[model samples]
Target: MMDVWKRLLARWAGGSLGGGWGVVLAAGVGVFVPGPEAAAQIVNVQALFDEATAPMGFSGTADLSLDWRTGSTNLIATRLLASAQLRTPPHTVLVVARGEYNFARDELLVSRFLEHVRYRYRLLPWLAVEAFAQHELDAFRRLRARALVGAGPRFTLFSQEEASLVFGVALMGEYEQLRRDGEVDAGQERLDPRLSSYMLGRVKLAQNMSLVETLYVQPRLTSVRDLRILNETLLVVTPNARFTFSMGFIAAYDAEPPATVSRLDTQLRTSLGVKF
Candidate 1:
């Protein structure tokens, strides 16, 4: 498929020297949108503890998503920390509308349109496949989409300690044709403000007992540019299925200045949640 695309581009445009085809292939695994499924309908909420210890600051996330899929289409509303979101996926066809609600100052942040659609097909008991494409959105206040595709598989591992471990690996590629409306000069083309490809994998040791490690790495035009290794553990207790408490810590490195937006320092966070 790669070769075919290359040849087609070469033949057209009078023997051009551009590998825009390669660029498209590079941005195929990082594009996706939220969906409303029966299994995911119930509000799922999570909270992370935040901390700071020299050269680092740690924090976790807290959010819940509501599912709406029936009749002629699908929709999802997710509320996290200081933000709320509304999404609409066109009746089985794949056009999505997204709006963000800001609570800190109480106002509408933005809204936009999205394209690209995909469905999943189970290949085996432990394997599944999903195909998607680059989604288009309207955002005059920020960077727009270029290209992205992310796909992978997940595995379930059980240990004698009654620990259920779930892990998955995915390859993501995205092209960021970022438009410089602010900050730097216009049409400056944020050099390498994109990651050609990225690797993502996570291991969940126990749901409420603790034990989780994740690896994330992506390049940018500014900020530190290197892979990051983070170690996190959570002590969680649930009074019931509807209410819970959690506290945790995180350590990160190889990701600071010139490659990211925040300082590369260890951090910590804590939070409480309730779902109905």
Candidate 2:
């Protein structure tokens, strides 16, 4: 894993790449972490992987959200996200990190952090291979830690100037450890081999406007009923080459969640991004 990141950085430093996509700003979205009394926790990152303006060389974006209220019920919530990508021809590497905190009534309600790294190498015009690693911690779900690594081939099902579709599948090993809460074996540690599959689609509605949709499914190799699914849809509009506005919806479901947590969670977000 370290070797992969090392190679990507080496390649990025080897050449002088040009062009730029200005800084992107995502605003007006407050992250709400589910507490023990709330629904399940699912963090979908598909919308974070920007497909528009895939400038050659290097690009990055940062997002921040803050909400505060001082009334009968005090509340404060904040979220931060940072992402960087390096594209060198057939090789591309992307990294993302996000953190969230929510507090209400002088008590901490939720805290979460997530990190992901992905690398893709194109072998042909229609085929490519990808590998990714992810680590996460969520206090809302009583999850102390979760990690996974996977690699597999991706195919370009269809491609056009205005529309495209892609799909991929991989086998991944997942490890999870829950916080000790004495509720339904909350403090147990488990590992499972699972199949991860996804489909991504993009379509241009008009000049400077587009829609992107992504769906992910993961099921244990031995127990198909133990499944996880996530779906995200985003509508993006770019008035010019420097700014972007987007609204997205995410829905996630876990077949076997914590006894105290619900099976489904959903989120809606709207943000404007500026690029330099």
Q: Against the true structure, whose TM-score is highest?
A: 2
Clashes of 2: 7
Best model number under lDDT = 2
How many pairs collide in each candidate, listed in order? 32, 7
Give the per-residue lDDT of model 2 (tens digit) for 72-91. 22356577778888888788
What's the lDDT for all of these models? 0.32, 0.63
